[model samples]
Target chain A: MYQTIGEEIQVAGLFKKGRFWPSKFKWSGQTFNIQKITLTAEANNGGVKLRYYSVLASGNLYRLQYNRQFETWRLMEIWCEG
Target chain B: MKGEVGLTGLNHCLSDYKDCWAHVDINSYFATLIQQENPALRGQPVGIVKESGRTCIIAASKEAKLLGVSTGSRKDEALLLAPNIRLIPAQFDFYLDATRRLKRLFESLSPEVQIFSLDEAFINLTSCKYLYRDTHTFGTLVQTKIKQELGEWVTANVGISWNRFLAKIAGETGPKGSITSINQENLDYKLATTKFTDVSGVGYRLEKRLKAIGIENLYQIKLFSNQELEKHLGPFWSKQLRKMSFGEEPNLFEHIDSNPHMKSVGRSITGYKLCNNETEIKQILYNLVLETASKARSMGLAGRQISVYLSGEGRYWFSHVTLPSYVNQNKEVFELVYHYLYKKWQRSFLVIKFGVRLSLLKPETQINQPLWPTWHKQRYLEKAVDELAQKYGLFTVRPASLLNGQLIRPEVTGFLGDKSFQLGS
Candidate 1:
């Protein structure tokens, strides 16, 4: 239900000492629960790799690709399923 | 085939026996008037409305008629048929003033003047034979006067015939901005081909009925025996229908009424972003009341019923209130509307247009003076304000409360109450 035509963003707890610094978290003086996310493929070419898996937002379309070796994702070459 | 040709010109001894009559019908009078006033509207499908609403089209130009749009057609229906049709609101007061001014021009040409409506009229040129050498010369003079006094944009189709019906038909079929006639010659040919509905007496509904009965042409209806027509259409209607078919005259006396009265006084303003504030709304109401009341005073009459209408932005939330007592006072009308506005509208920002109407009125003398001090004082204050406004001008003096920013003022709401509204006795 959280899926959109472009970018999908997510945040989760990473600390184990009963405390953790939230990355890419929107703070409104309150905590929010994470939900399932999905993104649409780029308009053309192969999926671009990202340091963190993130989908292309708007304007020129590009897909999200992840690198298993670096434990990160980056938008690499432009790719589209269609 | 038995049409008379040049009889009037040849037989001067029996000119009185002939008694030539003529009518000048303005093609699409209201729409054409607007087009003549604004050149941009020329050659477009124009529809005029008595009030801006979904309900009715008061008049339509020739261009509009071709699209199956007509007078009294619902605006929504007209729009569906011709989306690009131009819509114009009826300015009765403007037309009335122009009618009066044009009548003066007609009076100069002929002693007998009969105003058919705000847009059309007939002048009896029978008594004024000495004014011009021929009927054509006289028509040209009348045409010149109208063009000179009223704008050149306005045109009339002049019909010089023996009687009113033939003249009316002549004017209806004539070319734009010129004089034409249905004379002894070609009368049958004109009537034969013309649609029954296009004739003045037979409307669309009757035309449809006539066609269903295998009477598609006016000539066929004319050929039917009186007893045969009477058997199908009954006595009174058959008589009238037979007149239309035979090119005979109808009962013109019953049709013509002389005294014209203003039915209602109203004012509307556009371009006010729909407003939610109470004070601003009241100011618009006040201005409308002031204008209406002043018109009442000018016409020597007062309104007993006051109507207030507010249209929400883009055709949502439309409501109207009609008050019972005739009021020509601004304060009285505004106070009534104030209560309605306060009750219905939340202080939300969404009002685009507003209007006030005073109707079901009698003469100013008929304004009842109640024994209550508040009512009497309010009435007096209103009378004073209306008087002052007439002498000086609108907004020359107004309540301080009405100066608030929430009030909507439209560009068309020129200081002159000369066009948008008028009071009727």
Candidate 2:
């Protein structure tokens, strides 16, 4: 099952070697620990840069997007394993 | 005939049962791709259209298909068939990117992989038989890899046979996420049951022709003798159908390495917002020229003949001009197209579609120097700009005029209609 969660979230992570790696995030008043970052990609739109990540947390896959221009983070999607 | 006794001749016959060609076709490619990206859409009825305003459905998901919605169905028909169907516009960039990912997966399995279309491919797995016990195992492995790498929702039907045509038929006939094979032993039975229209190259026109000749199935093709077929159809088509009936591969498949010289390069834009004036139309033509020239240059070819066309309100206008020397620069092509349009300028109904075609192509290496030496400087400068565009992006450096006009982004498409992946914005 997949659901769209276009919500802003609080992320606690470390910026190591010029890369931001998220360990956990609080969304919808619930905290979840990310197990791994499966994929990373960058998208540019009219000079605004956005970094996207497909991460695994609590046996579910979640898509996280970081807007470098606005300095905001969004939880775009969630894939719940059935 | 005496000179054709080599690998070329061997490829035409099913001499080695161990060697096979595999055709992999994505099930409801566009619809499945959308589902793969958006998990919420999984198992839900969906239809993909050209755009929001467009009514025709280009693809329908399996769920939608169950409700009698299918490709080519109108929006009204689809909605009537499945009231809950979700309609999404086609995203060419996302589909192209997915195709590239599929190609990479196929290439890892076999060195000889030909992309048949945006969503289909043929792989030669003759050398890899030893690695897998049978074709079924090999097909399963390929499917598993695609699911693991691309997405869990992406599935394909694989067909294995001694030749490409039969492999394609097998794939089409098989259920999704399964592998089917047609061999020498089962070829005749399969053909006997299959409809003529179901075959690869047979279309409605050919099907009607075959029906007139009392032929309704693939097996019935053998009922007519070559002379009889030649009398009814032409000699070329007669021979093609006869060969297809026996499951013989065409000669062109043998010499696939030889690239045919491109006779023309063209691009057309349709279903876009109608342009209101000549200036807007010229702007669109300029963008088309840029794309056409880039395509010609990519193939290391240049064209001397240029043609422009505008069609709308059930009317069309076309004009062509042959240049003194072959050219593949954006400026040269744009100027020629603009001049032709300028000469034929007339206020007409809104221009809904337009095209630019460059013909009389010759290898860039074979082109002769122009009479004026200054042209050489322009050519060198264009080459440098092309390199930069190729590296950074196509839109990185473009004509200043294009900024004011609406331009359709040129998609990276292959000669065979395969599109390059457009990643990263």
lDDT for each of the candidates?
Answer: 0.58, 0.75
What is the per-residue lDDT of model 2 for residues A2-81, given as tens digits with 9 covering 90 to 100? 46788998888989989789899999899989887655546643245667766778867888888786788999878764
Candidate 1 on B1-425: residue-level lDDT in tens? 12222322111211431566667666676776666654456688889875444346878987898899988787789999888887776544345555657667777777776666556667776776555555456556667777776566667777666677776776666556556556555678778867665577677777777776789877788678888888877797788877777777776534454334456767776532557766666666776666666666566566666666666755544445555556666666666666654357554446657777777767666566567888778767766765564454455567787665543322222122333221111
lDDT of 2 by residue, B25-103 (tens): 8888888877776555789999988765677888899899889998889999998999988887765555665676777
Q: Candidate 2: which pairs clash?
A: none
For model 1 the local lDDT of residue A65 reads 35
Q: Which ten residues in a row have the lowest lDDT in candidate 2 chain B?
A: B1-10
Deviation from native of the Cα of residue B99 in model 2, angstroms: 2.4
Docking class of 2: incorrect
Model 1 chain B is weakest, by summed lDDT over 10 consecutive residues, at B5-14
Q: Model 1 reproduces what portion of true contacts?
A: 0.00
Per-candidate TM-scores read 0.55, 0.79
lDDT of 1 at B102: 69
Model 1 DockQ class = incorrect
Model 1 residue runs over 4 Å out of place are A1-82, B1-20, B26-98, B150-155, B184-186, B196-198, B201-206, B209-257, B260-293, B303-327, B333-359, B366-368, B398-425
